[model samples]
Each structure stands twice: as structure tokens, then as C-alpha cells.
Target chain A: MTNAIETTNLTRRYGKTTALANLNLSVAQGSIYGFIGPNGAGKTTTLRLLAGLLEPSSGEIRLLNQKLSGSGTEAQRLVGYMPDFFGVYDDLRVWEYLDFFARCYGLDHARRRTTVEQLLDLVDLTPRRNDFVQNLSRGMQQRLCLAHALVHDPPILLLDEPASGLDPRARVELRELLRTLREMGKTIVLSSHILSELAEICTEIGIIDCGQMIVSGSVDAVRQQLQGGSHLRIRILGAVEPAVEALQNTPAASRLPAIAEVRVDSSDERVLHVELANATEETQAALLTHLVTSGILVSEYHAQTENLENLFLRLTEVMS
Target chain B: MKNVQFISLQPNPIIIKELRIRMRGIRPYAILTIFLIALVAAGYGMYHLMLRQALFGGSMLSFQVGQGLFSGLALCEICLIVFLAPAMTSGAISSEREQLTYEMLLATPLRPASILWGKLVAALSYIFLLIFAAVPVFSVVLMFGGIAPWDLLKVFLLLLITAITCGTIGLFCSSLLRRTSQATVISYSAILVLIGSTMMAGSLWSYFSGPIWQPVPPELLYLNPFSALISIVTVTPATSTDFFFGGDVFGLPLLSQFAAGVVHYGPNGPVVLPIYRATIVFYLILTVALYWISTHLVLPRRRWIPRWSDVTFAVLLAVLIGGTWLTHDWWRVLPPPSI
Candidate 1:
């Protein structure tokens, strides 16, 4: 599949400090790409660069396969960007705000009217259409800003910390909205310091720290690339001690190259935890068969999926 | 296709948006009402005072009373325009940055020039409305007959030019500075210096050069907007009159030195005083140059000196030098160089 966004050795410097250094990023079309990083990890700088609000000090950027030029209006037309620190014009009514942006995008009057109506509905701000922007709640304003970014119907979206100040419900709404947009074939590059924020919706993820991207790829691919290994949780039907003993002597647990270590979960006596140096479905199945055959109370058998937060920490730590 | 072209030809969105907001508010209308009412009361009050003097002196010329009223009103409007232009414009771009909306604007398809002109025109349009509202009051000069229609037109043009220059300087500050309050302070400070320094320097130069043959120190007064207004009005009656007051005229009175001298001519024969023309052109070119700089600065992403902007600057400098050469004869007639 063609990439929707690509940057090669993109570097942005402020005086002697480099905000983003030799960053190479590739986002596939229609995928929700999550950019995770700590505070001042160059997430906002990268988003700003992609938005064309800041020119890179060096390197190349291609959005939707078109090389960026001076001013980047051509690339800007293809991307909708929502900055981390953004404010609406409090003096303008909700519809007027959207209408102004639509006009800037050169939408005709009739189209603007319809687009504003549809966008308000999409963002669920139809009731606040005539109200001044300042009258909206923080969450409502965030949604309105999201609607404003979508005014031109750009194919690629660059959102920096969109859920930063949002309440849990508002964050969920934003996630749902983004998911809908992704389903509609829009390539989304979302950046957030919150790891859980990117966990559910992102098809691919990148962890950046100290102006460098530590790891980036599909969620599973990144985890596997780091090879931080897998964690399996097995709960016995009766006593955890017998299951733990059986797991120690099992061929799949001892001889299998994938299984690195096996031990009982200390907090819960009935649960046995196994750490695999390398895990594959075949190895997991083999272990499960051996546990049953060895006469361990095969009540629960599961392979835990590595979460983005853990992988992010591992990658950022390794980079540091 | 026609409809699309027409839409594209419409005014900048920033202008439209600002105008719509300003027009909907009570502040602009209230300010307009108060401005006009004050102008009327002040003009009539001056007329009443002039009328009493005329009656007591036994030479009650209606033209004299009208001139007094027009001068009072014109001076008041000039002060108001100077004050209000910066007030309207000093926050034009800075406040957007403060409000955190500047980034969104910078990312849009709108050109930087469009945004700069939009803010300026929006502010000036309000000032124009205030000016137009007083047209009936200014027309009072017509009843008594010392002021010609052209004179009123010149006053209006002066007000506009002053507003444009001051407003552009304010915008330039707004673009360069981060905070609205900071921009406003700098803008007002710049305006005060522009208006005050010229006259102050002229007085000083006149006093210091008293030993030698000193003209009316056109070097210092050339950029003074207040002085420009006076010269425009003073030269109206005798189109061929010398607006530059020559001879050693010192102090504030030197501002009106246009009174006694016969007109002088350059190689091209007699023309309007070059200082007056230079003041107008100076402000006009300065306004345009400041506006271009403001637009350049307001871009969220600006290179220190892009090759294109460098070339544009070169071309502009070339044009300025070439134009100076073309108008060499006209400039030679401006008062002799002084400190």
C-alpha cells in the first residue's frame, strides 16, 4: 500500500537545541498511526512540521505522495491539523467560525452552508451552532476545533494531543470520531503522551523520546521487533502449586526454545505466570497441550497481549 | 464558473470576518455616536465662540467663522484618527496569537498579504465610518464659504492616509511582538514619536541655525502628519502659493511659515512643495513597506531571509532608486538640507 505520509531525516532545530533530529517516519494510508512520546519529546514539533506551520531545518517531507514546496499550501490542502495548544475565536459564533474556515478553503457559499451543517452534526455541536464559541464547554470547544480542522475534508489528519485536556468521556468521543474518520479512509497521525490513548485505536505506533523515534511499526511488529518477549498467565482449577510444579517439568516449558521462564504468580496463588523469551502460537499451543497431558488442572489457559504502554517504556528506555 | 470567479473576487475572509464582528457589536456604534456628537458640539461651540468675536469686532465675515469651525473639527478628527487607528490595529495579529488562533490562520490557503490587508482595512473601515458620519458636520463649512469641496476632500484623504500609516505601524508591531499589550504600547509610542519628534526637531534646528540663513527646516517637518494637514489646508486657497515658509522662522510659529513667501520653482517650473509631497509619499511607501514586513513576520513558518524575499527586496530597492532618479528634479526643490 502507498504511504500517506513520509518524512526522511526530518530535522528541526531551535538555536543550539534540536527539537526533532533526523526523524524518519512513514504512515500508511488509512491507518491510525499513534505517535507516543514523553513531554518535550518532539511530538508537537513533528506535528507542527507535518502541518507545515514550521519548516524543517533539514530533510524531506512528502504528504500524499507530493513533495512539499515553499509555504506547503499544496500539502496543507491534503492535511487537516489540530495543534495541541489551539483556541477558537470566541467572538465568532460556532457556525460563523466554521464558515470562515470554509471560505478560506475556498468553498462556495452553498457548499459552505451544507458543509457547516454536516460538520456540526458530525461533531455533535448542532445545538451550539448559533452560540458564540466562548460559550462552549472545554470539551465542546475541543470538538468544535476538531470540526474546524475537518472543514476542508482533508485526507490526512495530524492531531497533536487532541485528548490532552479532555475528560474521559470526551476522550472517548474523540477516539470514536477518529475511528470513524479512519474507516472513511483518512490517514490519521495522532500524538499523545498518554499511552492508553493510543492503545485501542492505533493500527501502528511509534515511540519517540528526546527528539528521536525509538521504535515504529505495526503494534505487533514493534513488540516483536523489540522482542521484549511475551507474558502468559495461566490459572489452575484448584491449587496453583501443582500447576506450577507441572509447568516446571513439562517438555514444552523446559525444551521449547520459545519459553524462557515459568513461575507462579505470587499475588494470586491459583495463577501461574510464564515469561517467554520468544512466543509463537505453535509454542503456546504446545505448552497448553503439555499442561493438560501432565494432569495440571487446565482451568484457564491464555497468552497475554503486550500492551503499548509496556512496549513504549521498553523502547524509550532502550533508546535512552 | 462565473459564480466561482465572483466568489473568488470577494474581499479577504479576514476582513469580512472582522467587519462582521465589529459591526454586530455595540462598542463601534456607541463610539461612532459619541464621536459624532462630540464633533458637532465641539464644532458648534467653536463656531459660537468665533461668531461672538466677529460680532464684537464689527467685521462678521461668514467665511472666517466657517474656517475657524473647520479647523477645530479637522484638528479634533486628526487627533481621534491618530489615537483610534493604533487602538484598533495594535492587537490585530498579536491578539490572534495570544488567543492561539494564529496557527490555524497561518496554515490556511490565504496569503499573508491578504491577512495583513484584511486587518488593516477592517480597522480603517470603522474609522472611515466614523469619518463619514461627520461628513454632514464638515459640510457646515460649505454654508459660510471659505472651504472648497476639494478642501474637505483633502481633509478626508489626510485622515485616511494618517489612519493607514498609523494602523500599518501598529500591525507591524503586532506581527513582531508576542503580546497584544506590548504591541499596543509600542505602536502608541511610535505614533507619539512620529507626531511629536518632527515638530520638536524643527524647533530645535530653527533655533540652533539662527546665526546662518535657515529655511523652515523642512528636513525635520517633512514627516509630520499634523504638519501635512496644516500645509494641505493652508495651500488650498492659492494653488500656486509656496507652502514652505522660508527665512529664519523659529519656534511653533514656524509651523505656519507658509504664510508670506511667493512660490518657488524647480527646473520643471513651479510645483507643489516637495516636503508636502514627500510626507505623503513617505507615509504611503512606509505603510506599504511596513505592511509587507508585517505580512512576512506573521507567517508561522518564516525563513530568516528566503531567496525569493531577498530578490523581491532587491527589486523593490531598485525600483525606489530608479523612481528617485526619475523624480530627481521634483525632490531638488524640497528645502535645503539641514541637521
Candidate 2:
């Protein structure tokens, strides 16, 4: 897929302090890409650069096939950016704030009203549309910020820790809202330190550490790339005679390491503990063959996988 | 064609929106109160000055007295500009930055230039509103004595120029300083250097003159914006036309022209003094350049241009010594020039 957002060697500096350095980024057109990093990891900087808010000291950024940064604002109009920490004009009610922002995006009065109403409803803020933004709870304020960002109906959204600091229920509500948005085909780039939160919602993840992208891709792909990693956990029943036979005969499975350990830990319950090293597509087939051929009444077979969170820590820990 | 088409589309009006937001806050009322206090003090001074003049002896002092006596109104307006400018603009952009709205606003399609223009227009609007309130106070002068309706126009226009120029200074400081107090201090210091220090320098320059009271060529008055404005507006109401649009070196009114008439005894065909023309053009151009730079300061660029706040502080020390030398009464071998 052509990237909706792309940056190459992008860097920004405030005098001697480097906000972002040698940054490379690409977000697929329709992917809900989670940008995970610790605080001060330049996630916000990267988002701002893509939105054309800050000019790169050196390097380039492109959004929707057009160059971003200085002297052009087309990219800005196309990207909705909600800052991590921001203050709304307290005097304006929820609907008024949305309407004001919609007007800022150059929306007409008639269209602004409809867009405001729709965005408020999407963020579950329709009821509080007439209430002052300041009076809203922190989570409601965040929902309002998200609603404000959608005023222009831009194709892409850059949300900086939208769920951070929100109550658990509010966070769940936000996650569900983002899920609905993704289903509706809005590309979103969300940044958060809460790995599990992103794990729940993001289709893909980019792990940034100390101003550079260590790795990024689908959750499974990233886990697969970890040298010593297990992507799937399987539970088997009835002695696994058919599976063991299928695994032994499978050509691809034959190349992988043998079951490293199998213990009669649950003999009373008629279960076995097996560790399959170098788990991959090839190994999985051979292992499955052994089970099917055995016909040993295979009862439970499921996978509890290690996801992007482990991959991120592995890459960042390796760098350190 | 593209440019024209761009213009035809509606403006985002982001600045105006922000300004409306700002106005709803306490700053507007606070600024208005300060502005009104200055005007009241000035009106009181003007009434007393007029009363003193009539009581002391009418026609004894000359038109110069008439002009100098009216200086209280100009002073009042300047004080208003000085006090309110720092309060209004000093906290403008920096407060937005602190509030974290700066980056959000920057993220929008509103260019820095548009933001600057929006801010300046908003600040000027408030200042104009303050000036608008003082209109009746000056108008009351007409009932008592020789103050013309044209003089009132000149006074208000002068106030407008002072407020606008000072507004630019305040805006520049706002962009550079992160703290409101720093912005205000820097703005006031800039005004002192730009206006007060020049006057001191002129006074000291008198020590080196060929003759002390020689007609100092009316052009020098432009150094003080108040003086230049008065020079143009004080011209006889009949000749106010000659000075308004793109004429002469200075922003002086008809009175300064009459003062110019005291010297230069030749056939009159409006011999535009190059020095006066250049000076007025320079200041006006400077004001425009300031407006332009302030626009860029508001841009959402990651890289910021070098700020001159530190350099300005250093230069001010030099100006202080230079001004002290000029204002020294003992250094003058001849007496000061009469009004």
C-alpha cells in the first residue's frame, strides 16, 4: 500500500537540543498504526512534522504524495492533529468548540453544523455539546479533543496519547471508538506508552526508542523477527499421537528443532508440556501433522501469543 | 489567477476567533480600565492647563504656548499606549504557548503571517476602542477656546499612529519573550530608546551646533513620533490636505509647516525637504517592516530566527550614557532654545 504518511531522515532541532534526529517513518494508507514509545521519545515531534507544524532541520516528509513542511499548507489541511497537552477555550461549549474548529478548517455554516453534530456523536459527546469544555471531565475533554480534530474530516488522524490519563472506562470507550473509526476507513496514527492498550486496538505497531525507529510492522511479523521468540502457545490433549506422526513426516517441520522438552507434568489429567523451539509456519505444519495422524483425541489446541509489546522491549533492550 | 482565486475563498478567521477568545478573558477589561484612567488624568491636566493659561494672561504666551499647552493630550495618549500595549500584547503569543494552544494553532492551515495580522488587527482594535472613548474628552476642548475640529482629528490620528507603532513593538516582544513581564519591560525600554533617547541625543547634539538657536530645520522633529504627528496635524485646518497623503518627509501637521514658514524665505512651491520626507518614509517603512517580521515570528516553523532581545539590552546601556551627555545642562555654553 502507498503510504499515507512518509518521512526520510527527518530531523528537527531547537538550538542545541535535538527534538527529533535521523527519523524515518511510513504509515500505510489504511492501517491503524500505533506509535509506541516512552515519554520524550520524539513521537509528538514526528507527528507534528508530518502535519507540517514544524519544519525539519534536515530531510523531507511527504503526506498523500505531496511534500510537507515549509511554504505549503495542503498537508496540514489533510492531517488532523490533536496535541497531547492542550487547553481549549473554556468559554466555548462542546458544540461551539467543534463548530469553531470546523470553521477554522474553512467549513461553511451549514456543513459545519452537520459535521459538528456527527463528530460529537462519534466521540459520544452529543449530550454535552452545550456544556463548556472546561466543565467536562478529563476523559470527556480528551473525547472533545478527538472530536475537535475530526472537524475537517481529514483522511488521517495523528492522536498523541489520546487514552493516556483517561479513566479505565473512558479508555475502553475511546478504544471502542477508535475501532469503529478504523472500520469506517479512517487511517489513524496513535502514540502511547500503554503497550497493551495499543495491542488491543492497533493492527500494526511502530516502536520508537531514543529518536529512532527500532522496528515496525504487523504484530505477528514483528514477533516472528525476534530471534528467540514464540508467536503461538498450543494446548494439546489425548497424548498427541496423531500430531506427533504428522509432525515427523512433514518435510518443513523436519528441518526445525525437535521438541526440546516434554514432561509428564499433568499425567493425572492426561496432558503433556512440550516446548517447540524455532516456531514458524513450517514447524507448525509438521507439528500439526503429528497430532492429526496420531488420532489421540486431541481436545484443546489454542495459541496465546507474544505480541508487539515483547518485540518492542526486546529491540529496545538489545539497543541499550 | 491562483492567487486571486485563493483570495476569493473565505478566510479561516482563526486569528479573529482567537482574539474573540482573548477578549472574553480578563485582559480586555483590565486594559480598558488602565486606558480610561490615563485619559481621565490627561483630561484633568488639559482642563487645568487651559484654566491657568486664561487666568495668567491671555495672548501673552503666543501660538507656541497654545501648542505646548495642548501637549497634555498627546502625553495622555502616549501613556495609554505605553501602559496598555505591554498588558495586551506582552502575554499574547507566550500565554498561548504556555497554554499549549500555540502548537495546536500552528498545526492548523493558518500561516504565521495570517496569525500575526489577526493578532495585530485585534490589538489595534482594542487600542482604537480605548482611543474611541477619549474622543468626547478632547471634543470638550472645542467649547472653551481656540482648539479646532481639525486639531481634534490630528490628535486622534496621532494617537492612532502611536498606538499602532507601539503595538508592533509590543507584538515583537511578545513573540520573543516567554514571560509577560519580560515582554512588557522590553517593550517599554524599546519605546524609551526609540523615542526618548533620540530626543536626548538631539539635545546633546546642540553643543556642537554652529549657532544654538539657528532654525534647526523643522525636519528634526520627526524623532519623536508625537512631535512629528503634531507637526502635521497642527498645520492650519486649510492646509491639512497638503500633509495627509504621501507628502513631505515628516508626519507633521500644518503648525509645523507654519513653524517651517518662519524660515526659508523664497518662492513657495512645496519644496519637499528631502530630509523630512526621508525620515517620515523611514519610520513608516520601519513600522511596515516590523509588521512583516512579527508575521513571520508567528509561523509554525521548528527553527526560530535569532532574537534581538539580548542585543537590545546591550545597546540600551550605550544609549543611556549618550543621552546623559546630551541632557547635561552644564555642558551647554549657550542657553536652551525657546519654544
Candidate 3:
């Protein structure tokens, strides 16, 4: 797949402090890429750089295979940026707000009129078209901001902390809206400190901390790469001590070569949480067969996947 | 193709937006009403005072009454320009920063020059409206027949130029400073220094020149709008046409001693350039330079960094060269009339 946005050694500095340091980023067309990081972790800086709002101290940015110039005016047409913190103009109606931006982009009058209506409708804010921008609720304002970004209909959208200050329902609505945009083939890159917020919607995730990207890939790929291997949960009827002892024995260890470590669940003694070392489905089946032949009553056997929150915490902890 | 480009640039969006916001509310109308009322009251009072003087002196209404009333109204209008012009635009860019809307505007493809131009035009348009609204009061000066329509036009032109220069100064400060209040304070302070220092310098130069009747060089008063106005209204056949600082109405004892013309010896005779013309030229150049600097300051990432002082130095150099070129006849001497 072609990359919608690409950066090589992108860096930004403010006086003696480095906000972003030698970062490489890539987002494929039509994919939702989530940038996960803590506060002051250069998430906003990276977005600003991509949005062409900040000049990079070193390195180059390419959007759709064209290198961005220093002024970023040409690239500005291809990227729609929604800043994390923005203010709406007072005394400006919602449609007028969109129209103003449209005019800024030098859109013709007829196009501006239709574009404003389409954007308001797309953000589901058509009902409040004439309401003053400041009078809208926070969530509605966010959507309006998003709508403003879309006025030019850029193919790539850079949203910084788009879900912050949003209620659950608003967040869900935002997600749906993003999904709709994605279906229309926009490469969406959004940032957040919360991993769960992006985990469900992001096709790909990059965890950045301390001005560096720790790891980036498809969601499952990052999980697998970070956790090293899958985990198995085994529940045997009655005496779980036998299963634990049997799994720990040298003979069983040799037979079940995939088993790395076996521990009984602290709360439920009959359950065993087994860590596997690079175990495939065939190896899991063999291990199950060997356990059953050893006279252990097995009631439930399944793999327990690690959640993204635990992975994020563990990854950041190790980095720090 | 050129026509298309020119057509696209008309009617900047910021001007439209600012005018809508400023005009939609009742505050501008209220301020305009109050401003007009004050001018009328001042005019009425000056007219009555002039009428009583004529009555007491056993004379009919004459040119002196009209001239006095015109000067009073013109001075009042100049004061309004000095105070209101800067206040209108000092908050133009800084308020955007305060409202957090500056970044969004910067992110667009609109050139920085367009933003600056839009802001200046919007601020000065209202000021121009205020100046033109008092035209009827100014027309009352025609009844007594001392000030001509041509003189009235000149006065309005000076007011317009003064407003533009003051507005540009406020905008420059607004772009340089981060907060609106700071911008406003600095803008007013700058105007105070411009007006105050010029008057003081002119008076001091006349004092130390060794003779009471010697003309203080016109360069000192070229940037003072008040002096320019004085020079314009007080012109007569007896006094040199462009002489300023000849009037002693403010009780400055030294002003009465100064000659009525800024005279420079030339091969032929004394040369005089109208102080109002010099003032207009100097201010127009200044407005352009300040507009340039403010545009650079408002940009998110300036392509080139030229210090404000550097621009100021360049402008001063241009003014000096232009001033010398405009008065080049002073450089041609005839060896003391072949003594």
C-alpha cells in the first residue's frame, strides 16, 4: 500500500529543548493510525509538524510522495489539521465559520456554499447551522472544528487529542464519524494519551514517549511483538496441584516443549495460567493431548490475550 | 491573466468579518453618537463664543470668527484621531492571539500581508467614517468664509493620513507584543513620544538658534501631525505659505518669537516646502514600512529575520535622502551673491 504521509528523521527544537527528536513516521492511505503518548511526549509537536504549523529543525516530510516545502503551502492543500486546543470566533454563526475557512482556502462562492452545507451535514451539525459558534456545546464545537478541517476535503487528516474533553457518547459519535471519513479514503492520524481510546478504532498504533517512537505496527502485530508469545489458560477439574506438578516435572517439560512457565491462578486454584514460548496451534494441541493422557481432567482450555493497556504500561515502564 | 489575479484579491475576508462584528453590536453606534454630539457641543460653544466677541467688539460676523471656529474644530478632530486611531488597531492582532484564533488563521494559505492589510483596512475604515461623519460641522465653517472647500479637503486628507499612520503604529505594536493590553500601552506611549518629542525639539531648536526670528528647520516638524495642521490652517500672504510654529495661541512665549516660514538660502532666494506636504510624504513612507514589519511579525515562521531596528534605520535613511532630494535647491549656493 502507498503511504499517505512519510517523515524521515523529523525533529523540532525550541531553544535548548528538543520537542521532537529524529522521529520517523509513516501512515498508509485509508488507515486510521493512532499516536499514543503521555502528556508533553511530543504528540502535539509531531502533529503540528505534519500539519505544517511548525518548521522542523532537521529532516524532511513527504505527503503523498511529494516533499513538503519549507513554507508547506503546497502541502497544506493535502492535509487537514485539527489542533487539540482551538477557539471559535464569537458572533460567527456555525455556517459562517465554515464559510470563512472555505474562503481562506480560496474556494469559489458556489463551491464554498455547497462545501459548507456538506461539511455541516457530514458532522451532523446541520440542525444548528445558524447558531452562534460559541453557543454550541463542547462536543458540537469539536465536531465543528473537525468540520472546519474538512472544508477543503484534504486526503490526510492530522487530529491532535481529538477525543479529549468529550463525553462517552460524543466520543463514540466521533469514532463513527472518523470511520465514515476513513471509508471515504482519508488517511486519519489522531493522538491520545489513553491507549484504550484508540485501541478499538486504530488499524495501526504508534506508542511515543520522551520524544521517540518506541514501537509501531498493526495493533495485533504490536501486541504480539511486545508480549513475545501468547498465553494459555487451562482449567482442570478438581486437584489442580497435579496439573501444576505434572506441567513442572522434567519429563512433562520435555514432552510439552512449548510450555515456558506454569502457575496456578491465585483466586481459582483449579485454573492454570501457562505462558507459551513461540507456540503454534499444533504445539498447543500436542500439549493438550499430553496433559489429558497424564490423567488430568481438563474442563476449559483457551488462550488469554493481553489487553493494550497492560502492554502500553509495560512498554512505557520498561522505556522509562 | 493579470486581471484575474487582481480580481481575486479584492475584499479581504478579515475586513468583512471584523466590520460585521464591529457594526452588528450597538456599541459602535453609541460611540459614534457620543462622538458627534461632543463635536457639535464644542462647535456650538465656539460659535457662541465667537458671536459674543463680534457683538462686544461692535463688529458683524467676519472671517476671524469662521477661522477661529474652523481651527477649534480641526484641532478637536486631530485630537480624536491621535487618541482613537491607535486604540482601534492596537488590539487587532493581539486579540486574535488572546482568543486563540491566531494559529487557525496562520494555518491557512492566506498570505501574512493579506491578514495585515485586512486588519488595517478594517480599523481605519471606521476611523475614516468617524472623520467623514463630522463633515457637516466642518461645512459650517464655510458660512463665515475664512476656510475654503480646498482647505477643508486638505484637512480631511491630513486626518485620513494621520489615522492611517496611527493605525499602522498600533498594528506594528500589536504584532510585536503578545498581549493586547501591552500592545495598547506601547502604542499610546509611542504616539505620545512622537507628538511630544517633535514639539519639544522644535521649541528647543528655536531657543538655542541665537535669534528669536530665525526659522527652525522644517525637518523637526515634518512628522508632527498637529504642526502640519497648524501650518495648513494659518497660511496667509504675509507669512510664508508652509510656516508652522508661528502661532502663539497655546501661551508658549518662545513660539511667538519664531518666524512664520522655514526659510533656507538658495542661489536665487529662500526656498520653502509646505510642511503639510512633507508631513504627508513622511507618514506615507512610515505607514508602508510599518505595514511591512507587522506582516513579517505576524507570520508563524518568517523566511528572513530582519530586526525591527534594522527596518527603522532603513526608513530613516530613506526619509533623509528623500527629504534632501525634495529640497535639493538648498544645496546650490551662489557664493554670497558674488560679494
TM-score of each: 0.88, 0.74, 0.86
Model 3, runs deviating above 4 Å: A233-240, A246-272, A285-301, B1-10, B54-60, B202-217, B235-273, B305-324, B327-339
Pairs that clash in candidate 1:
none
lDDT of 3 at B22: 79
DockQ of 2: 0.27
lDDT of candidates 1 onward, in order:
0.77, 0.65, 0.80
In order of TM-score, best first, we have 1, 3, 2
lDDT of 3 by residue, B1-339 (tens): 000111254368888888877787689899889999999898788777656645565243466557666777888899999999899999999998998888788777777778888989999999898999999988997998767899899899999999999999999999999999999999999999887787777767746776543456677777888777765664331222322222332112122332233333345554333577777877877887787678778888854576564576587758766875776555322222210
Instruction: Kindly indicate the candidate among 2 and 3 with the higher lDDT.
Output: 3
lDDT of 1 by residue, B1-339 (tens): 011111365558998899878888788779888988999898777766655655565344677556656766777888898999999999999998998888888777777767878998998899889888889999988898777898788888878888899989899999899999999999999988997777666545545676743545455665677666665555322223322111211112333443221123334443334355556667767876787677678776654546465576657756765676687666434542332
Model 1, position B296: C-alpha lDDT score = 74
Predictions' DockQ, in order: 0.38, 0.27, 0.36
DockQ order, best first, reads 1, 3, 2
lDDT at position B182, candidate 1 = 98
How large is the i-RMS for each model, in angstroms? 4.6, 5.8, 5.7
